[model samples]
Target: MESAVLTQALMRPAAYPHPVSKVTLIETHISQVFLAGAFAYKVRKPVRLAYVNFASLATRHADCEAELRLNRRMAAALYLEVVPIIAGPGPLDVRIGGNGAALEYAVKMRRFRQRDLFSTMAEADQLTGAQIDTLGRQIAAFHESAPVTGHASGHGTPARIAEVMEAALNGVAELASSTEMTGRVAALLRTRAGSLQPAFHKRLASGHIRECHGDLHLGNVALIGQKPTPFDCLEFDEALRWIDTISDTAFLFMDLLHSGRQELAYGLLNAYLECTGDYAGLVVLPFYTAMRAVVRARVLLERAHQRSAAGAITTAEMATTQMRCNDLLDVACFALTRRPGAITIMHGLSGSGKSTVAQRLALAGAMVCVRSDVERQRPPHGHTAGGGDLYAAAQTARVYRRLRAVCCLGSGAGFPMIADATFLARGHRQQFASLAARRVVSFSIVDCNADLATLRERIAARTGQGRDPSDASLQVLALQQRAQEPLGSDEWRHVVRVGEPAAVE
Candidate 1:
């Protein structure tokens, strides 16, 4: 880290547009920032690090130029340009034109108010739901339009991430001795690494990696004209910048949850999934989130050791970072334990609109809709009381078994279940109710009621259109009415009149 050259470089008049009455130097682990009036300039230290390399003066200048170029993709108004400083050595005492040869380059940027950063906004409680949603849309659009890279180049694959994690841990180990907590953390990382291998291999084969914002989190986001915008993407390493889109977005999601905004985290995730139709990517979220948290923890730990005299964060802040890291690790472990199994039963007679309602609910969450009508309509599975009919028996058994299986799976995975079915017969209703009761899980039976004429007309229209699963005619509807059993006063059965809002009781 040679500061004499940089100090002289900063003294040149070409570095500043206005008179430099004073120059404030800010140093971080990787770079030195110079704050001048109305502008800030960053100069990468000529230091080679394991995760990032800025070893040579030429490489540092090239990286500074690359940073300006890449960041302009998202923040054109902020990244002014990279300017070369012409200087002559004299203990760094020089002015804009006061005698100097070409020395070095610096990334000049428009200085934004500290309050514009999301971290500051969050501290002030100014980060709102609308802003989160806006960020979701922005990131979604960014991912949609970002360049796609070849399988070998994309940095999002599991193997690549594992390598990064290993490198990061190596760096941490180099900085500190092995302790009980570090040992546990290392073990957990190994387990997560193992779990992601298969999935990572699949992505590698499928070429799911693309160019992404390598570093995305609250601090990198800012409000310009009251609009949340993402900026400061990592431009130093092409390997770090190209990654799985989910891996890119996971950092923000983890940060949100860590900030005590779990609901917003969930909302942002759902929104992104909906926009991108990357539901399958959900499986990899917890792993990426934990990795991001650990990375932040490592950075904060380093910061605790090197904080400036007056601006250093308190001891409590360091402890909080440790706690947050532990919490994130726990979340990652919990997610690994979850196995997807979900079932929704659509229960309602012909013309009751139970299928319609079930379809709507299914769109909001991850659940498989099992329709009795569809099951019954399968070839020989049609309504017939004949014990010899194997297809009929199998389909009936499958309908019941599928419902039960889904309920068990959803309960175990901690997901909400919506069982849609027509509970006309007491025995049929009891079967599901009993299963739910045994699991101590919530159940809602939507017993739909409508005017007889209206029901008959709806059934006729459905039959004429050939779109409805139920083949029941008017006569069958009459039979259904005669056989219908009233639901007893219970917490689970929710009897609602057709076209009316649902009542929980």
Candidate 2:
């Protein structure tokens, strides 16, 4: 049977055994999704693309099974099963999910509301930081538990990653005459990808590579049961799915930034780092971010070309898609452009609003903030080497050292960073100053201050809320006050003050 005939049958509401008044058939370049009342059935197109080949019945079935198995890893409740599309004896009598020799295979999923999708929320200006925050934590947990690759898979190696990036770049570039993803954008992406091979290999060696949700854009996520549930992972390509966790994160981050939600991007990145403590990813994130943008641009460009060739898209629609693709390319170029780096270290008591200032800088995309309290709590995943003495003098010194290393790495990569901690001692402050000098980046000490009563009240409220990672107590604040050393004249020269209306800038 022809593929279009089967899809036409599935589009009929009567073809479904379940009670449905209408069937909405949404078509993509690779798949046809029939949204029945309570369920949706997806059938892959039997076409060979540069990246994916679903030309044969067997291959389509295998890809369907792969999609079902992999999507169930994170979204168990949404993906129900893979069902066979059977044809009855009568002519033009195709039935959905029945017992017979199958003509096609379909992935059956429980239908979810369109309004709950992250893309929908973002389009309506309803997406929130809290939602992105929750999304970050959930994705972190998922990545930590996802299976690691063996030596033979050859999935996460720099060669394989570059292969995929180059393919995506070329695919988008082929459609460049009709698309706005021009030759210049492709050249920039190629140059940046080539330069970041060492960083990619480093992440792979450090076990940052694993099976990830390769397609982690907003449209693939939904707020199911008040949780940001990710579904529809990339199943056609192993190299795309098996990658550095930061690469997976960079997709959604790029999507948010492209959608003009910078604060949500910062919240998402910060929240994920808080959970996983993978601050080192900050250096190579721009490269990964550009790659993701190219990937997205490929999707848009390819889809527009395919539809135009099929006579399924109007000229106006194709022009609109081209503009969107150009916008994504612009974002790709901007992400790769490096700005002058700087360091901002917080100096204040526990409740003196130091963390607040750090958060503001991060939200503005001015810097990546690393908090001491969060780092002190995580001790090598399972070793627990320093878990028993979080506040011991040696432990504190170790935390400062680690913070300086991360700051230097980020600054060296042309990204500003902030170390969120009470720099009460002169020695701790000097280490960061030395790092800034070595990196040739400007350094500022943000001295956050508030009245004593306000400080105590804020700490009390934070303790009651219990959502903050900080475990600072009243006693800790007392100790911070007594241990605080007055900044010398030299130290005062590099000071930036906060906690005042006009001082933040």
Candidate number with greatest lDDT: 2
- lDDT, candidate 2, 1-505, per-residue tens: 8987887788778777799999998877799999999998989999899889998999999999999999998899999999988886578877877788889999999999999999999999999888999999999999889888886778777788778878988888787553444677767767877887888778887788899999999999998889889999999989889899999999999999999998898789888888888878887888888888888988888888888888989989988887888888888888888774798899988888887778887888646789998887778545654436577788788889888887887787677889999999999999888888887778899888888887898889989999887888999889888999977799888898775622432
Segments of candidate 1 deviating more than 4 angstroms: 4-15, 19-26, 88-90, 94-100, 174-178, 205-207, 306-505
Model 1, TM vs. native: 0.66
Per-prediction TM-score: 0.66, 0.94
Residue lDDT tens for model 1, 37-78:
777788777666566777777888889889998888888888
CA lDDT for candidate 1? 0.66
Provide the RMSD of all predictions against the true structure, rounded to 1 decimal: 9.7, 2.5
Backbone clash total, candidate 1: 16
lDDT of 1 at 305: 53
**In model 1, how large is the Cα lDDT of residue 15?**
53
Q: Candidate 2's C-alpha lDDT?
A: 0.85
